[model samples]
Target: MPSKRKLVAASAISLAIVAGVAAIYQTFGGESVTSSVAAAAPPAAEVDVAAVISQSITDYQTYSGRIEAINYVQIRPLVSGTIVAVHFRDGATVNKGDLLFTIDPRPYQAEVDRAAAQLASAEARNGYASTDWARAQRLLTDNAIAKRDYDEAQNADREALSAVKAARAALETARINLGYTSVTAPVSGRVSRAELTVGNVVSIGANAPVMTTLVSMSPIYASFDVDEQTYLRFLSHDTKTTVPVRIGLANETGFSRQGVIDSVDNRLDTSSGTIRVRARFDNADGVLVPGLYARVRVGGGAPHQAVLVSDAAIQTDQEKKFVLLVDKENKVQYREVKLGEQHEGLRAISDGLQPGDRIVVNGMQRVRPNDAVKPNLVQMSGDAATTKGSS
Candidate 1:
């Protein structure tokens, strides 16, 4: 027979064992086990989804460029003299033939007077010589004067006439120098500050210092380099028709100005594999400044059908770009894609996508390939939710 206390302790141990087995069975048995697993499994991830947008879009190529002035003039003095007066405010808009600076006119005026006096004296001498020559002709005809005297009178008359012509030429030169005393704007433009102020002496020569700069305010230029493919595709074929272009400043988000292709380089640069291109834009408001950074968009050829998507949906897979495609089963499938230039606010898909395909646009980082997702339909470009289901 067992002891009483030992029997009681054995009974309690048996009850505990029974309870443990029942608990284990409830957790791991048939339907119970299935229910436990079902409770533990996570729900499908929610993500923003939209169908790919397909439209006829112009194929545009973008390039970094610089704003330039169509006509940039460095104002230099044509005559050597002291600058007597500055006629324009710094950075002021000036018209053609507007006086920019005034040099001292006293010296040129004196030269003009001297040349005029010389011309007058030569004319008087020429008058007297003409009279003498007439008299000599009469004398020769009458045989009253020697032939040698008549010949001398004829030579003197010719000399006086030559002197008068020389004086007239000198007078013309003096008048031209006097006109140069007023330095005027050669073209309508915005003028820079005067490099040489009043009382500053300037000289005329090949190495002469520039007095100021003037740049045309309207019809500005934007210059850029284009690759060989772009030049061949859009520029080389057009012989007469103007190609259209657009430009955006550094601070702008979109291309706001419309322009036309102005010119193209004659030859390609073998070293750079590009050709220089220039476009002209109207700057009637004078907002475009030279040397500013510009984003040039060159569009040509014909409109073509393209599929577009938001940039947020793109993913980088090592050396390749990819996106998450949500099929009809709501399963995310990995898709590699080739990209093209951006149009409007969306990126154009050159390959690996088609119209009506649903793509994960947001929350891409939360899901993986083949994972089940709960897609929330939205616009490709906007944040507003839509009632449309995934395609």
Candidate 2:
């Protein structure tokens, strides 16, 4: 009977061991179940990716420059004399030949009168000499007077004729001096401050410095300099095509005038390696002035159809230029591109892009290679009309 009781106890212990093993495995299985639940959750979708496409990408370039007068001239006193009067007010508009100052014309006029009187006297003497010479010829022909007396009269007549010519020359010189007494403007323009006082002596002499200045207000010159690289690059692309220009004062917001290229520098400057280019604008409003610094823009390059993207879209890593190209499937692929030239805010994609190829513009930093994305295609319009796919 004791043996039977022992066997039953052993069987109960064995069943308890089997149940404990099953419980341990069940707890671990619960942990695995929780992990699977978390992993099964869906991920957030990516913002729609849009490809950068083109409309009309304009060809534009930028350069720094200054405003200049088309006709710049200096006002100087023409004659030497004491300044008697200031004809025009300082900083006044002057017409061509407008009197700017008055030299002491009293002295010049007196000299002119004296020369005129001398000329009259010389003319009277000449008339007398001519009559005497004629009489001498008649007397010599008839042998009415001694030959020596006739010869003496002829000599006096010749001297009087020479004196008349000298007097006439003196009168002309005096007239020129008198005209110079009134200093006049060489060109029509705004007169600068008076360089000479009313009482100061001025001329093309020791005090003959510039008395005033005049710069043509109409048809102003916009002078800008381009580096040698640019000149060569632009010239290589376009030859003799006129580039447009615009100018405005610093205080003035909107550009007040428009113009075109008038001339280019004769030679490239070796020291600075820059060439000066000038454009002419009609400043009929008299707003532009000489020496006023301004911004300049020019457009000249290979003529071809091209796709343009915002310069900001271009990303650079090390020495390579690259862009993020979004395919129609909303897949982002990094593309290496060759650049042409930048115009305004857009850059020409010389290679690696085609017309209507969408590109990543904003929010490009969050993207990675081969990352799945949802694309929100943005339309290119307005200034984008200038964007042409690579040619």
Candidate 3:
């Protein structure tokens, strides 16, 4: 047997060797477990994808507008008189030349009769003077009257003729005033309530109060403003080609009314960088009212090939717009895009995208860039039919 000190040293060495072996085993075993876990990965995320559509599209820009009447007339009296009768009901539709009000024809008729009597008296005097002049001419030829007396007779005839002409002119004036007693519609339109009712006195002149208002019922106007860039790009190119326009009411969803650009402002407004444009629309149904809100859409030039996609595919990344695209390696990629006009339910991709490019339309939030995805191919129109594929 060894001594006590030797035994103690031998035991210590044996224990240290066992501890070293245990540490090595634990380290290797832990590494093996970690390696096994790293080899496995979660399943690819499922997402709806669609191929960008290619089609010829005409770009259209929309703007807020207002409906206006083609013809807006304010009814006013031409002569001053007491209103004797109102021919139209309040808010009645009247045709051109339709009688609207009668302003006491009795007074005008009396003046006309007085003028006629005065004209008749003047004509009688003129006849007598003419006969006297004829007699004076005969006396002068026969030398039966003095020269001065014949001259006086001739002068009297001329004066009487002048008086007759003056009387005839007065009669014509009286007849015109009489005709003014009846206030007629100058245009065919819907009229407002009479401002001056029966027994109300109306005055003539520019300062005269409007008796009522009238607005045309058909072929109305829709006015809107177009930005300078849009006007230069679309409207300025073709001076003669009719620019197509469409309008919708406040409650309408789409532009239901078709119209043509009627007139454009001569100069663009520098302050707003826009040009005022007016469109003519047929209001035969009498549904369009003046001063009503309207939505105006102006179509650009000829249709051109364009790439389109559904709005759902577009993602907003802070200030920039992008879409999640799936690559052939079953990984998601980011694509920045410039947007143009919207047609139907599809948005036109102005730049940064091509036709047939697969983009994630649904389940975009579940995936990130370079993420593997199980793409379910669907139409860009959001149809139900789909095909499963790994992307």
Candidate 4:
């Protein structure tokens, strides 16, 4: 009944229907369908990782302060007169008892000569009186002179001896004044500029004529202040003996010199709530000078061992500090931490960390907690390099 063309057309329709049916059947079939296409996911982002999690750290606090000298002295003239000559140049170093200045000695010398002449005259008078007394005594003993006359002669001789003793005392006083004319340095130190130069009149009382200023330099002092809390913290521990210290110029890094704690102020300042502490260092190199600002660090207590991380490695929230940790499966996790003082670029972790733990240092913003990521090798250069440690 059907023609050849119709038969061919029907066969084509049937084949199409049959294939569509097979596709539908496969979509809901009991047997599962398999395809080569994988899940459409975002590409893995590169990240930097750090494996060093915990370390030993000695906790420390910082303070700002100034420097001073251990032994500072102001030199003054003992007597008043024009400074005829100065033995030491301004700001020169001198030993103890070194001649510093000279005052005119002619005045004192004249007084000494006057006293000596008085002594000689007194001695001559005493010699004559002694002869008279001897003669009087002889006459009295022979019953040719009165006892009153002999007594008078003895009195005269005694007066002359008293005058001689007085004159000798005056002469000694003059000699002492003459010796004081030559001034001297009292201590061995580096002296400051001579406040009084040659021809500058100095005084005993008009004012304390400061001839020079001296400061002991071999063992100089470094003065720094600690806040009330910090001062108390160090004192609470047994620091009866010397505490350790190190110093450097304020702007310079790395404390280059080591010293010892020389003293601790007994009282805390009420106004500032800080206590002054001092350390003595041997400035043999003359590197440290007076009035210099320095970075001073004090060390104490038992050695502390703890987990440490770079400051950049740690993240801070409103009230807490945390870090991103990467697990073995390349998954990241957010870990909270308790932090102590930060020194240099590292922080002392007080809690919530351990050694050998891996952390995400670079690409932190790109990853979240429990994020699946691909950790690429961290190159030493670029913006992503924010202080990383080998994992």
Say which candidate scores most in lDDT: 1
Better of 3 and 4 by TM-score: 3
Q: Model 1, stretches more than 4 Å misplaced? A: 1-45, 130-158, 238-241, 369-374, 382-391
For all candidates in order, the CA lDDT equals 0.92, 0.75, 0.88, 0.76
1-391: candidate 4 lDDT, tens digit per residue: 4698899999999999999999897787634433212234576677887665354556566555566777788877776778898888777878888988898878888989998998899899989998998899889889998878888999998998898899889889988888888977777777888777889877787676788788777788888888877666664455624456778787776577777777789888899888888888888766666898888877666667876666667898789889998888989888998987655556677887788777777789998998888876442221234443443
Q: Give the residue spans of candidate 2 off by over 4 A.
A: 1-63, 66-71, 145-147, 222-269, 272-281, 295-302, 316-321, 365-391
- lDDT tens digits, residue span 1-391, model 3: 4699899999999999999988887978977867788878687999988888899988799999999999899888888999999999998888999999999888889999999999999999999999999999999899999999999999989999998999999999999999999999988888999888999999988789899999998889999999987888877765524777888888876789998888888999899999998989999888988999998999977889999888878989898999999988879999999988877668899998987799998898899999999988777773332455422
lDDT, ranked from best to worst: 1, 3, 4, 2
Tens digits of per-residue lDDT for model 1, 1-391: 4699899999999999999998898777878777888999999999989899999999998999999998999999888999999999999999999999998999999999999999999999999999999999999988999999999999999999999999999999999999999999999999999899998999999878799999998999999999999898999976513677999998887899999888898999999999999999999999998999999999888899999998888889899999999999999999999999888778899999989999998888999999999999887873333456534
Error of 4 at 261 (Å): 3.1
Native-to-model Cα distance after best TM-score fit, residue 94 in candidate 4, in Å: 3.8
Q: Model 3, which residues run further than 4 Å from truth?
A: 1-50, 134-153, 235-241, 326-333, 362-379, 382-391
lDDT of 2 at 322: 87
**How does each model score on TM-score?**
0.79, 0.70, 0.75, 0.68
